[model samples]
Target: MDADVWTERVARDYDTSSTHMYAPEVLGPAVDFLERRAGQGPALEFAVGTGRVALPLSERGIRVAGIEKSEPMARELCGKPGGEDVPVTVGDMTTARVTGAFSLVYLVYNAITCLLTQDEQVACFGNAAQHLAPGGRFVIEVFVPDLQRLPPGETARPFHIGEQHVGFDTYDLVNQHLVSHHYTVEAGRGTTFLSPHRYVWPSELDLMAKLAGLDLIERWADWNEAPFTSASRSHISVWRKPPSRTGTL
Candidate 1:
C-alpha cells in the first residue's frame, strides 16, 4: 500500500466516512470473535487504521499492538482516548517486525487486498506468522471476489449508493486488480478517493497460509460464526501456527 495515499486529510476524515463500520452491530461481533481467540494477552493488528478495532479490543482488556504504514493514520489512532496504550510500529505490514510475539495476529477489513500482488500477500501471511507464538492464531476478514456478479464484459460495479456518498469498483480481471472509487458530498462540497486492491480467492489465501506454515482451522461467513458458503460475499478465516515440538519456533 502507498503510505502517501493516507494523508492527514484522509486520516482525519476516515472515521466519519466509515461511520457505519463503527456501529455496534458491526464492530461488536468482530471484537468478540478476536477476543475469544486472543488467548492470554497480546494481539497484533495489521493496518490498524484509526484504531477502530484495536481500541475496543484493548478496552476489553486485551493487549493490542499494531503495524501501520501511514504515519497520519497512526497519529489519528494515537490521538484517540486509550489509544496511547496500544503500541504501533510505523512500517510495511509485509516486512515490519514488532518486538516479542503475540497470541493472535490479525488483518481485518480486507486489508490484505492492499498488498496488490500474490507474492506480497503471501509475504504478509509470513510476516503475521513471524509475529505469532507457537500455537497462536492468525486471522483475516476480507470480501470474496464477486466476479460472478459482474455482468459479462462489464468492468465496473456499484458497491454502495447513498445520499451522502456513492462508491463503485472497477476491475481488471486479467490482473486481478480492482480500484474502488468513492465520491462523497459533505457540507455541499464533493470529494473523491480511489483505492486500488488485488482481489484473491479464498482457495488462494488458503494456499498462502500453507506456504506460511499456518493451518486453516476455521472459516465463517461473518463474525457471527455463520457458515461460509458459495453464496457468501465475504468471510472471516482463522489459521493456526503449529505448536512447537522441539521448543523452537
Candidate 2:
C-alpha cells in the first residue's frame, strides 16, 4: 500500500500499537538528542505522526514543525494537546517545503524506508537538506536490514509477537524491498495492516546524503549514543549541511 492509504488505515491505532516507542525509556533519549541539536532554533519532523516525539520536544521549548504525507495522521496529531501549535505541511517528504529553514530536521522510527524507491529516498535527503539552515543537522532513525536472520530460502521473519499483536517483515531480496505486516488482536478480533518500504544500506544512504550536499557527522546504534556495530539492529544517524550553503539553490 502507498503511504496515504496505509497511514490513514493505521493512524487510529498507531500510538497504542507502537506503545513501546513512546515509553520514556525509548523516547527520552531521542528528544534529548534532538533538543540539544536544535540549539534554540526550530526543528522539523519529516513524518510527525500523532505528535509522539514532536509534542514532548516542543514542551522542552523548541519550536517544532512537520511535513506529513497523510492528512489523517496530521489530524491525529492536531487533536492532541500542543498539537495545534505545530504547523504541518500535508505532502510527501521528498518535495514538501515549509516556511523557514530549521536548525534540525528529523525522520524517526524507520520512516525513511516508507519511500519505496531509491530515487524517492534520495529526494527525501535533498528535501531535508533544503529545509535545514547552514550547519543545520538532519537525523534519521532506521533499522539495519537483517538478512542474516532469514534462513536461505525464507523471505519473512517475525520481529514481534505479543498477546495482542504480531508483527513481521517480508523481504523481496531482488528489489531490496520489504513489507511490514502487523496484526493487532482485540477481544478475539484481529486486524491486519501492511506498510511497504524500500530497505537501504548504510553506504547507499551515505551516498544519497552526499548527493544532497550533506556530510555525515555521527551514527549510533540507538538514541542513547551507543556505538554502531554489526550486531546492532538499528541506527540513529546525523548529517550536517555545510555551513557555507545558506539556502536551497
Candidate 3:
C-alpha cells in the first residue's frame, strides 16, 4: 500500500501501538544522535509521523520541520503541544519541497522502505539532498533484511509475537519486496493490517546517496553508535553532501 493509505489507517493508533519506540531507552539515543549532528541548525524529517522524534528534538532547541503524506497523521501531530509551530508540508517525501535549507534531513524507523520502489527511494534521496545545505547530513534508521530467519522454502518470518499483538513479514525474494502483517487484539477483538514495503540493502542505499551527490559517512548498529556487524539486526546510516567551494566565475 502507498503511504497515504497505510499511514492514514495507522495514524489513530500509531502512538499507542508504537509505544516501545518512544521509550527513553530507544528514543534518547536517537535524539542524541540527531541533536549532535544538527547542532544549532534546523532539521527536516521525512514521513515524520505524529512528531515522534521531531517534537522532542525541537524541545532541545533545534528548529524542526516535516514532510508527511498523511493528513490525519499530521493533524495528530498538530494536536500536540508545540506541534502547531512545526511547519509540515503535506505531500510525498520523495517530492515534497519546503522553504529554506536544513542542516539535517532524517528518515527514521524504517520509513524509507515505505516507498516500495527503487526509483522512488532514489528520488527520495534526491529530494533530501535538495532540502539540505552543503555539508548537511541525511540519516536513516532501518532494519537489515533477515532472510536467515526464513527456513528453507518458507516465505514468512515472525518478528513479533505477543498477547496483544502478533507481527510477521512475508518476503518476495525475487522482487525484494515484503509486506508486514500485523494483528492486534484488544477487548477480545482482532484487527489485521498489512503494510507493503521494499527492503533495501545498505550498499544499495549508498549508491542512492552517491547518485544524489552525497557520500556515506557513518553506519552503526543502532542509535547508540554500536559497531555494525553481521549479527546486527538494524542500522543507523548517515550520508553527507560535500561542502561548497569558492570559485572565480
Most TM-score-accurate candidate: 1
| Regions more than 4 Å wrong, model 3 | 7-9, 246-249
| lDDT against the true structure, each candidate | 0.93, 0.90, 0.90
Residue-pair clash count for candidate 2: 0
lDDT of 3 by residue, 1-249 (tens): 275554556788777666667889999999999999997789999999899999999999999999998888898999999997787898999998999989999999999999989999999999999999988999999999989778999999887787777889999999999999988877887777788889999999999999999999999999999999999989999999888885211
Q: What is the lDDT, from 0 to 100, of the residue 62 in candidate 3?
A: 92
lDDT per residue (tens digit) for residues 128-193 in model 1: 999999989999999998899999989998887888788889999999999988888889887788
Off by over 4 Å in 2: 245-249
Runs in model 1 with CA error above 4 Å? 246-249
TM-score list, all predictions: 0.96, 0.95, 0.94
Give the Cα error of residue 124 in candidate 1, in Å.
0.3
Per-residue lDDT of candidate 2, residues 1-249 (tens digit): 166654666898788778767789999999999999899899999988788999999999999999888888999999999998888898899998999989999999999999989999999999999999999999999999989889999999988888888899999999999999988887777788888889988889999999999999999999999999999999999999998644531
- Name the 10 consecutive residues with the lowest summed lDDT in model 2: 1-10
User: Which candidate would rank higher by lDDT, 1 or 3?
Assistant: 1
